[model samples]
Target: MLDPLAALRTPDDPPCDVYLTGSVFLDIIFTGLDSAPVRGTESWARGMGSSPGGVANMATALARLGLRTSLAAAFGDDKYGEYCWESLEHGEGIDLSLSRTVPGWHSPVTVSMAYEGERTMVTHGHEAPPEESAPCDPPLARACVAALRPGEGQGWIAAAARRGSRVFADVGWDETGRWDPGDLADLEHCEAFLPNAEEAMRYTRTDCPRAAARRLAEKVPLAVVTMGSEGACAVDGGSGENAEVPAVAVEALDPTGAGDVFVAGFVTGTLAGWPLADRLAFGCLTAALSVQEFGGSLSAPGWAEVAAWWQHVRSFDDQGRAALRRYAFLDALLPGPARPWPLRRAVPTIGFRRV
Candidate 1:
C-alpha cells in the first residue's frame, strides 16, 4: 500500500510536462444529418468517424501543442477501453502508462448527430463506476480519482495540489443534482477553476456568468466561466479584479467538446506563463478551431496551426486586438504561417465559415 501523505511530499520532477486526470471516451460522430429521428424511427446517418472526446480531447490538445502530457483516467478491460488507451498511446507527446484498465464495466461512449456543423449527442456510461486500485505510480495515482462519492474526488485533488502540480478542475454536469458547494474545498488549492456557464449558474445559483465567476473566485485563485458566443469572463482572486475576454467569431461546425478544448488552451497558456487576457484569447482561438472540424480531438489544432492563426489575427489594430496578439505571441513561441485579413475575418461576430 502506498503512503498517501508521503506521496503528497514527493519531489516535483519534470518528467511529465502536464498531468491531467478526468473523463475519457470514444466518440462516434455522424455528420450530415438534418435532425434526430423519433425513438421508433430508423434513419440513415452519413459521415461517421471515431475519435477521442471529453478530457481525453483536452489531453490530446495539450500534447499536440508540444506538452509532455499524461492521462490518468479509468478505462474498462473491454474493447472500447483498449481503443481509448491505444489511441492515446499512439498519439505524439502523450504518456498513457499511468492509465488503468479495470476488468468490468463499459467504457464511456457517445453518439453525435451533426447538421451543417452543429451537433446534438446522446451518451451512455454514467452507470459504470471506475476501479479503485490499478497499476499506477504516485503522480498518476494523484491524478486518477475513482471517488464517485461526495468527498472522494476533492481528496485526490488536494493530494495533487500538495505535490506542487498545477491543478485545473472541470466540474461536470453529474455533480449538478447532488454536489454540495461546501464540499469543494479542493478549489482553494487549485490554480484555476473552469466551469461552463450552465455549471457556474447551477453552482452559484446566479444567472449572470460574471456574478458566478466572482462567486467562484472567492473560493479559488482564479474562476473562469465560458459563455459560448458571448465569450468568457475571469475573476482574479489575487486582485479582486474581473476581465472579460471576447470570443473569436467563427462558424461553429460542432460545439461538442468546445468547452473542454477551451479549458485545454487556457490551461496550456497558463502553464506557459502567458498573461490572463492572452490565455483567454488562446482558449477562444482553440475552441473556434475545434468547431471547424467534425469530431472533437480530430478538430483540435496543433501548435503550428494555432500559431499561424494567432499571427494572422494579430496583424490588426482594432480594440482589444493588441492584447489578443500579445497573448498569442507570448505563448506561441514558434513562428508559423501568417493568415491574411487578420481583423476583418478573425474577429467577426459569427466566426469564419468553411467554404
Candidate 2:
C-alpha cells in the first residue's frame, strides 16, 4: 500500500482512514458477449471472472488506493463467503474487525453479464439475521463512505460524523421511482454527496448535471455529479471551489464498480489535500483504468498502476500537453520507479486443482 496519508498520520489519529458498511456479494462476471443472452437460447461468454462485489467494490478500491479501510458487514458461512473474506481481509489487507459471519445464511451471489461496456446483473440470496444478536459497532475512522437509500435509516453515519469522520454519501438507484431528497435526512451529517448525472438531475430537478450539482451543493458541503463519458463535476460549498474534469479515453471492458473506484480515488485526493481539479482528474483516471480490466474489486488500480500509467502516457507524447498537465500532481505522490507487484485479476473460480 502506498499510504497517501502517511505524512498526516499520528499515534493519536484514528487507526482507519476509511470506514464503510454494506452487503458483500460473490460476483461472477461474464464478458466478451456479442449481445445479451437470447431468449430460449443459450449464449456462451468468451471470458469470465469471479470476485467479491457490492460494497466490496468500494472497500477494495479504497484499500488499493492505500487507504486504511475498515468494513462492517455480514458474511455467510458458505464456501463463496469464505472466498470473499479471504480476498478482502488477506488479499487486499482490509480490516474486518467490525464484520461477522452468519452461520446458516448463504452469501449473496450476483451473476453479471458484460456487453458493449455495460452490464446486466442478476442477484440471489437471503438477508442475514438481524445484527442485534451480535451487534458490531463501527470503529473510529477519518472518513466514511455511506451508501444512502430512500427510507433506510443511517443513524450510524450521524454518529460517525459526530466523532469527526468525514462522511461521503452515495446512493443506489431509487427503485420506488421516488427520488425524494427529503428522505435522505442524513445529508446534514455528510461532507459530500456523490451521484451520477441522471440521479443528480432527478433529485435536483435540473436540466443540466452541473446545475444539479450546484443545487445539491446547497444540501451538502460538497456535491459531485458524474457524467458517464463526459466526465465529472464538483462544487465545494465551503471553499467555493468548482472543478470539472473530462473522462479519460480508454477501452472499457466491465464497467461494474467503476463508480466505486472513482469515489475511492476522489477520497484519496481529498484526504491528501490535492487541488480540486487534480482530485477530479485523478478520480476519472482511476475509474477509467478500472474499466479496462475484468472485475471491480480486483481491478482497482494501486499506486503501481498509477505510477506505471503516468510514465507510459507521458513518454508516449500523444495525450496532448493540455490533457496531461492536470495529472502533473502525480509526480510528487509516486515513489521513484515503483513497479506493481503483480496483476490480480479474478479467475473463473475460487478453487483450482493443484499441480
Best by TM-score: 2
Q: Give candidate 1 regions above 4 Å deviation.
A: 1-13, 103-106, 115-119, 126-152, 175-179, 311-332, 337-355
lDDT of each: 0.68, 0.89
In the predicted model 2, the residue pairs found to clash are none
- Give the TM-scores of the predictions, in the order they appear: 0.78, 0.96
Model 2 spans > 4 angstroms off? 133-137, 337-340
For 1-355, candidate 2 gives per-residue lDDT tens digits of 5788989989999989999999999999999999998889999999999999999999999998889899988999989999899899989889999899889889999999999877899999987788766543457899999999787877788889888999999988999988898978889999999889999999888999999999999999999999989999999998888989999888999998999999999999989888888888999999999998888898888888888888777866558465568788887888753335775778998767679
lDDT per residue, candidate 1, 1-355, as tens digits? 1111222243754566577767778788776576766688877775566777767777776666556677777786777777667667864447877777767767888888878545778888964464566433337322322112235444556666677677777676644485467756667667788888987877787879999999888888899899889889899989887778778777766776787788878876676566787778778878988887667775666765666666666675573385464464644365443322121111101122459
Task: Tell me the deviation in Å of residue 100 in model 2.
Answer: 0.8
